[model samples]
Target: MRLGIIIGSVRDGRFGEGVAQWFIPLAQESAAAAGDEVSIEVIDLKDFDLPVLTSATVPGAANKQYVDERVQRWSAAIDACDGFVFITPEYNHGVPGGFKNAFDSLGSEWAEKPVAFVSYGAEKGIRSVEHWRAIVSNFHMVDVRTQLAFSVFEDVDEQGSVAPTDSHADRARALVGDLISITGRLVTTR
Candidate 1:
């Protein structure tokens, strides 16, 4: 299965990239151990500079008429993936505006796909996850209940690097394993 590790933060000096870097290899190893052939791709929101929603037509699971080229590109990427792992940072107890905007840009590509989250922040970014859970459900995406939440103060090192300990790896393994299992079933059915 093609799994997208979407970097959900676009802020300067964001910690999302480091978390993503740490999680990718762990996910790969876990999937390999499970005898699942999975391809992990990093989809950074920064690459697609999707503007905030200003369209008259509301984007939904059935609507795919995106006027912007960037939106189109983002949509295509999502369409190619069988599942997703979102690396998110909490901003004011919610998801980053850019990450939310990227989702708003296009629609339907996420339907019936499995999504997991690896979030890091002061509060482990659980609030962001809560917000995303409610939102992604609108697109009919199945979310894995097993998620990895990294506390910035605990999981991240003083040098601003994601220095995950053994426990973190175990959590990632569970999350990735669940993602692979769920995606495998969903991909075949979809």
Candidate 2:
């Protein structure tokens, strides 16, 4: 399965990149254990030049006309992926605006895909992810049960490196295993 690991934060000094770096190898190992072919791609929201919803076309609209080439490329990337792992940071108890807009920019590309979360914040970013879960469910995305949440104060270092507790490895393994299992099942059905 083609898995897109989305970096959900785009601000200066964000810790998402380090988390994603830590996640890729675990995801790969989990897929290998299951005898599944997994290609992991890191999708950074900062790389996309997405404008806030100024286009007349909404994402789920029929015959959607994208505002520009960047949006098209973003949609294409999402369409190519079978599942996703979103690494997010809790900001003011919500997801970053850019991450939300990225989701709003495209529609059916996310439909029927399994989405998991690896979030960090003062207390594991659970509030932000709770909102995200509700939103993605509206898009018909399958929520992987094993979510990896880290407390920024505890899991990240001053150098902006991810230094998760030893127990987090087991949680990450569970998250990846669930992602592989759910995505594999969905792939067979598709």
Candidate 3:
């Protein structure tokens, strides 16, 4: 199974990158321990360069047909993943605009897949996770309840560095475990 760890932030000095860097190894270790052949990859939104939704066709009806090459590549990447872990940052108590646009750029690629969340911001970015739950439901995606959330004030320092505690590591492992378990089941159905 391929697990895509999507770095949802694209800002110049985004904290989500640090979060992904820290979480990837833990997720890999967890997947290994789960005895599942899971390959984890970073799917950074920064690499996609997706524009705001400007397509004449609604993404749900696009059938993976996109005019722009970038969107096509993004669709292929997303289509290859069996599950996802979205590392998101809350901006103004909501999901980041770029990530949302990137998500909107594709449709069926995300359908019926499992997704987990690792978010950071005020209140540990739970608001962003909550917002994501509603949005991803449109694709009938399974949003795992076990999630890892980080507080900007508590988990980050002045240098924009992330310092996750052992407790955070524990949560990450649990999230990965649940995602893998669900993905395994979903893949069989698919």
Candidate 4:
């Protein structure tokens, strides 16, 4: 299973990246022990030039400012991956604008792909992910039920990494394993 861990926030000091850094390896290791090769890709929005989305410049527009060639590349990457792990932080009670733009630029590429969430915020980030789930559903992607939510004030250290805890680590690993199992069946059941 090829799982793309999409960093869903683009702020300079955003905590989502730190969470993904801690979350991905644990999941990949679990899949490896099951004798299934799972490929993990981290999709960071900062690396791309995706700007404010505009309809005149969104779908077929050649405008590289609001919409760029990189959007197309990002969409292609989604198509190549089998599933996703959206590492999102709650921003103003919803996902950040950049992440929404990144997701909005793509169509058809997200279809039939399984998705999961690892949300972090002051209140465990469920509010942000609730919006994300509905949005991914519009793209026809299957949103997995398991989640690993950490709080901004309590779940991390001064270095901005999740304070290594055994219980959360175990749950994180199991979440990935479950996603792999269910997604594997979903992809092949046809």
Candidate 5:
């Protein structure tokens, strides 16, 4: 299975990337050691300067298109994945706009893919997960039921790595397993 983790926020002080950096590699390593041959990638929205939608652009997902080179590159990278793990942060009770814009740039890229989330924030990032799951579903993707929800006020350290909590780490590992399983099943159908 080709699994991609989309780092959800591109804000100046965002902690999302650090979390993704730790988890993506661990997932790859665990899969490798287990001989499951899972392939993982991280998709960062900052690489694609997808602007807020303008009045000049087309309106619906079917007609929407990328107007920037970054968005095009973003699509190419996303096109390589069979599933996703969205590392998200909760902001003002919702998801950040950058990730949403990245998703909007290409309508067909997400269909039939499976997705999972590792969301964190002051409020544990659960709202962000719910929001992302709905959006993924709208795009005709299946979001695995299991997820890793970390509280910004709790689990993460200043360095971006999760603190040494066996239970939390176990949950993360379980979520990754679920992601791999769902992705494998979905990809075969595709």
Candidate 6:
């Protein structure tokens, strides 16, 4: 199984990178323990610089025929993954606009895939994760309930770095395990 860990924040000093850096290795370890051949990759939203939804056709009907080069690349990247882990930051009790735009730019690529969330912010980004659940449902994506959230006040340091607790590591393992298990079952249907 190929898993894409999407860094959904693109701010200049976003904390999502730190979270991804911490989570990736742990996820790999969990996959190894599960005895599944999972290949993981980081899909940074910053690399794509995707524009807001501007194509003439709706994403679901576009058939992956996006005119924008960046969107096309984004589509290809998402299409290659069997499942995803979205590392996001909460902005004003919701998901970052750029992240939501990046998500809206794809359709069938996300269909039937499993997804997990790891979010950070004032409220541990739980509200953002909750909002994401409704949006991903539009693509019929299966979102795992085992999420890992980090509070800005508690899980971050003075240098604006992530300082996850030991318990967070256990949550990461459980999230990855659930994602892998669900992806294994769902990928067959796709």
Global lDDT of each candidate: 0.86, 0.85, 0.92, 0.79, 0.76, 0.91
Order of candidate numbers by lDDT, starting with the best: 3, 6, 1, 2, 4, 5
Stretches of candidate 1 off by over 4 Å are 61-63
The CA lDDT at 178 in model 3 is 94
Tens digits of per-residue lDDT for model 6, 116-156: 99998888999999999999999999999999998878887
Against the hidden true structure, what lDDT does model 6 obtain?
0.91
How far out, in Å, is residue 17 in model 5?
A: 2.3
Give the backbone clash total of model 1.
Answer: 0
lDDT of 3 by residue, 120-162 (tens): 9878899999999999999999999999999878887677688
Query: What lDDT score goes with residue 68 in model 2?
Result: 85
Tens digits of per-residue lDDT, candidate 1, 1-190, equal 8999898888888888788888888887876787747888878889988878787777774366678777878888988899999998999999888888888777788889999988888999999999999989987999999988888888868887888788888888999889999999988999
**Clashing residue pairs, backbone N/CA/C < 3 A, model 2:** none
Candidates 2 and 4, the one with greater TM-score: 2
Clashes of 5: 1
Summed over model 4, clashes come to: 0
For model 3, state the Cα shift of residue 164 in Å.
1.8
Candidate 1 accuracy as TM-score: 0.93
Q: In model 3, where do residues sit more than 4 Å from their true spots? A: 157-160
Q: Which whole-number lDDT from 0 to 100 does residue 167 have in model 3?
A: 95
How well does candidate 6 score on lDDT at residue 85?
A: 97
Relative to the true structure, candidate 4 reaches a TM of 0.88
lDDT of 5 at 20: 75
